[model samples]
Target: MIYDGDEVEQELCVDLYWSFRSPYSYLALHHVRALAKAYALRWNVKVVYPLAIRTPDFFKRMDHMWRPYLLIDTQRIAESLGMPFRRPVPDPIVQDPRTLLISLEQPHIHRLTRLGAEAMLRGRALELVDAVGTMLWDGSVDGWNQGDHLARAVAAAGLDLQDMETAIARDPQARDRLIETNEAELRAAGHWGVPTFVFRGEPFFGQDRVELLLWRLRQHGLQARSN
Candidate 1:
C-alpha cells in the first residue's frame, strides 16, 4: 500500500517517538498511519533505540513476569486491532536466549535504528517505519533482515535502501546523536517509551492512549481532510 505524505495543510503537528524493536510500536503504526490519513497533520517521527538498547539493565531490573506479560498483552492488542503480531525472528536487539541478557555487539538494532533516523531525515519516516514494521512484525516472513525483505520494504516506502545506507555511513555518529536527542526530547516530554506521541507539549504514552491523543488533537482543532 502506498502511504500518503502530509499533502494537506499542516494544521497540527505530532512528535512520535518510535522504536524498531518494540512490538507496541509496531501495533501503534496502524493507528499512526490512520491518523495521518484522516487528519491534516504533520508528523515529526523520531525513531529511537528500544529500552533494551538505550538502557541495557532495564529488563534485568524488571520483574521476571515482565517479558511474559508483554508478549501476552502485545499479542492481545494486535489481535484486537486485527493486525498480525509476532516477535521479530532473531529479535532486533541481540540477546542470550536462556539468560535473556542483552548483547553489547548489537549489529541488527544499530543498523536498523540508524536507518530509521535517516528515514526521518528524508521526510519519509512514517512511510519507512510503517512498511518495515509490517515486514518485521506481521508474521508473514522470517529472516526479515535477510534477503531483499528490508530493501523491498524501503522501496515500498518510496526510498532506496542503498541510498539510505550511504547517507547514514557518511556520518553514522550524527545519526546516533539524533537518536540520543530524541531520547532526551522524549524524557523532556514526560515519558520514556516507544509509541509515545507528544502533541502540543502533552505526552501520551502507549498504543492504548491513541484515543486520548485523538481526543486531545480534536480539542486543539484538528481538522480532517476532505477526500
Candidate 2:
C-alpha cells in the first residue's frame, strides 16, 4: 500500500529498460514483474539499442572477454531466479553498424515499443509490459531461432501484431523518432544498459540492482533515514 505523490495517486512509474540483444537484459526480465507487483509500481519498459552499435570495435574486443562473462553471469542470475534461459540463437542482434542486423532495428521491435508506449498512454502499460517482458525473458521459446516466437509474444500481451505492424510500417519517421526518443531518455537516466530502473530521477542499472531501487522506493515512502 504505497501512496502516490500527488497527481493520479494510484501508480508510480518505474522506468524499466533493456536492450533487445543483451543476454543480461533477457535474464533481468525474469524478476521484473514480481518486483513491480511487490512494490505496487507500474513499469514503463524502455527498449534501447545496445552501445555495441555505436562502438563496433569495442564490441569486437569485448566479444572475446565480455561475452563469456555475460554468459556466466547471466546463467548464474537465471539459476538463482529459477528461470529458464538459453543462449539466444543467432544472438538476436549482431553488433554490426553497417546493416543494423540486430532485432533492435527490426519492425517487430519498433512495433512492440510503440505498442508499449501506447499501453502506457492508455493506462494498461503495466500489465501489457509484464506479459511481454515475461515472454521475452522466457528463454525456453528461443527468441532468436523461432520465427513466429515474437509474434506469439506480442499476441500474448493482447496486442494485434498485424495491426501494429501495419501501423508501425506506415510511419517510418515516427518509428525513428520513437527509437531516438527512447535512446535520449536512456542517456538522460544515466547508464544506457537494459534492466536499468529509474525512480525519482535516480538510475539503478542491472537486475541485481533491483533490490536497491526497492530500497529507495521504500525509503521515499517511509521516510527512512539513510545510514
Candidate 3:
C-alpha cells in the first residue's frame, strides 16, 4: 500500500507519548524518525513530564534490584541497536541517590518539555528531540542546555529557539496544561510509558515493541518508498 497524503480516508496517524528524561526515548529516536519518514502520516508527539517529577514516590516502593537491572538490560539493548549509551549529564532529576528524594528545582526538564511542545507546534518535533537528546544522552557535549547548544539544536530543526521561548513564555499555562493533558491521555490509553506508540487507539509500549508497531502499520497499508 502506497500512502499518499491525498486521501483523507487513507490517513494514518500515530500518537507518540514521550519524555525528555527517558534514556529509552533517546535510544528510540532513530526508529521514530524512520517511522515518520517512511510513511505518510501525522506524527502527533504528545510530550509528558518525566515520571520523576509527576510521581515523586514512583521509585520509593520499587524492588531494590530494579535500577541496576534496568541499567544492565538497557545497556544491552543500546548495544544491540548500535546506539551510544550513557546517563544524561547532571541527570534530569535533582534527587539524592542515597535517599532518592527528588528536589523541586528542576529547571531543565520543564524548559525542555515546553520547548518540545513548541517544536511539535512547528512540525519539526522529531528532529528537535533527536538532536537535543543526542547531545544530552551522549558524552560529546558539555552543558547540554547551555549557551549555543539549544540554539544549535533548534536551528538544526529549522526553528528559532528565541522565538519559541517567547511564544511559550507568553502562555506558560497552556504548555503546562498540555503536558498534564498528555499524561491524562496516556492513562486513558492504558499505559504510562515513554516511547509508547499509539495507532488507531491501540497502545504499543516500549522501544522493543517498535517492530510490532511497524507490523501494525503494514496492516494499515503504510507506504514504503520505492527509491
Tell me, by lDDT, which candidate is best.
1
How far in Å is the alpha carbon of 34 misplaced in model 2?
1.1
Model 2 Cα shift for residue 77 (angstroms): 1.1
**lDDT of each residue in 1-227, candidate 2, tens digit only:** 45557633445667877665566766666567666445566667765655655444555454456656876888888888888767544444443534433334544444556666555444565556555555665555655335776667666777765666676567656755656787788789797767688887889988788778777777556332222
Q: Model 1 Cα displacement at 53 (Å)?
A: 0.9
lDDT of 2 at 142: 52
Whole-model lDDT values for every prediction: 0.89, 0.63, 0.82
RMSD of each: 4.9, 5.5, 2.6
Query: Which residue window of length 10 is worst by lDDT in model 3?
Result: 1-10
lDDT of 3 by residue, 1-227 (tens): 43435543465789988888898888788688777777776778888888898888888978889889989987888888788878877676778888888887888888999998888777877777888778777667677777797788778878898999999999989888878998999989989889888987899999888999888887767766544
lDDT comparison, 2 vs 3, better candidate: 3
Candidate closer to the true structure by TM-score (higher is better), 2 or 3: 3
Q: After superposition, how far is residue 141 of candidate 3 from its true place, in Å?
A: 1.1
Worst 10 residues of 1 by lDDT: 1-10
Q: Candidate 2: worst 10 consecutive residues by lDDT?
A: 95-104
